[model samples]
Target: MLRVSIAQISPDGTKEENADKVEALIRMARGADLIVFPEYSLGARLEHADRLAEPVDGPLIRRLAAAARESGLAVIMGILESAEGGPYNSVVLMANGDAIVAHRKILLFDALGSIESRYVRPGNMPLTLVRLGEFTVGLATCFELRFPEIFRSLAAAGADLFVVPAAWYAGNLKEEQWLVSAASRAMENVAYLVAADSAARAFVGRSLVVNPWGHVELDLGKGERLVAWEISRDAVDEARSALPLIEMANQHMGTWARVRRIY
Candidate 1:
């Protein structure tokens, strides 16, 4: 079993303030094997993303790495990244005092009164997976959760857990969509899904953790919260053994490939 803590906090336009909050949360998350923070945890608003964007090796990431190393815990959180074309919505996984992997947001949230493409560049990089103490964790950010294909690809690459750091926008049925998508991704991939979302007014704060069987082990409402739970590898094995969905998919992948080529 892997002990994990999720920190759901509202991020403002102040990076230092947000960093302080992250430090406080890490202090509260003592003894956890893995700690997660919501997207925009580095304090980048949509309109001001470009101004706040920083490189992966910037001060914020360095501070987070230091915290992870000091606490002896792996960390996952979202931030705006300065890139060649523009800023990118990105997430980084920190362990052993370094960034082991970083995933840029592929599916930018361009709808619902917000235009991410204007300030955020869409990434074309492949999915990233990292090992965290008996778990191979896949990384995704925000809108990527809406695309099951991304999750399927990660599962095919042997990810046992999916971590999503999101600043999901609030709207009609938005919260419901968040819950359903998280549960669906967990069940279909037969992997644990842990999503930490921002609690800001413009975003939904319903951070959640789902088991391989589609059970919501933990769910936080519209408030700032720090919660911890254990995820069992045995449970994942049991679910796959019982359902065999992934196994069946693997078996027929060749046939599907042939059909796709023929078409």
Candidate 2:
């Protein structure tokens, strides 16, 4: 069994304070094998995102990486990243004070009036699959949950888990749709789904972990807190064996089986 810790962060625009909260939570969840943090919980300088961005080796990420190394835990976290051209919304997979993988958000929510796209350059790379223990984990941001093809692609690439760091708004549509998406993603992909959400002033704080059988393993409250759960990889194998959606992945496969768009 693999234990996961979901850190529900409530940010006050102070990067140090947020980092301290995360660090405290990480220490509290000492026995966990993996720890997931919310997006932009460290702080957001919307107008000067490029200036505020940091590399994986920078202070913020380095601190988390250090904690992961000290605790012997794998960490999946979201942060604003600065590179050659500009900044981008990125998630890092880290262990032993080093980065294992970094995935940039491909689908920016610019059309939804989120100015994040204005500051962050859209990424062209596909979803990333990182090996953890006996399972492969897929990385994605909040908005990416609405796209089924993204999950399908990752599942096909042998992703057995999905980690989402989100900042969802406080509304019925957002809440309902997000829950639906989380459960559906787990049910369809037959993988474990862990969603860590920020508990901000105007956002909902329903951080959750859904199993391959679409069961809620853990659900955190809107208040700032850390929740943990243990999951077995055998559950994933069993779920897939029972409901073989993978076999039905491309029912429309013709002579051109490999050439098909994931509508």
Of the candidates shown, which would achieve the greatest TM-score relative to the real structure?
1
Residue lDDT tens for model 1, 1-263: 89999999988748777878887788678799999999878775778887777677877778878888888898898988778778888887888888743798888888777778888888878888888888899999888899999998999889989999998888899989999999999999999999999988988898999999898999988888999999999998888899888778888888887644455
CA lDDT, candidate 2, residue 163:
93
Error of 2 at 17 (Å): 2.7
Off by over 4 Å in 2: 250-263
Model 1 score (lDDT):
0.86
lDDT tens per residue, model 2, 1-263: 78888888876656667777777777787888999988776765568676567777677777877877888888887777777788778887878778733688888766555666788887767678888777888999988888988888888888889999988767658788878999999888899999998888667779999999887777886878787888889998888899878656755435546576899
Pairs that collide in candidate 2 are none
Against the true structure, candidate 1 reaches a TM-score of 0.94
Per-structure clash totals for the candidates: 0, 0
* TM-score (all chains, Cα) for each model: 0.94, 0.91
Global lDDT for candidate 2?
A: 0.81
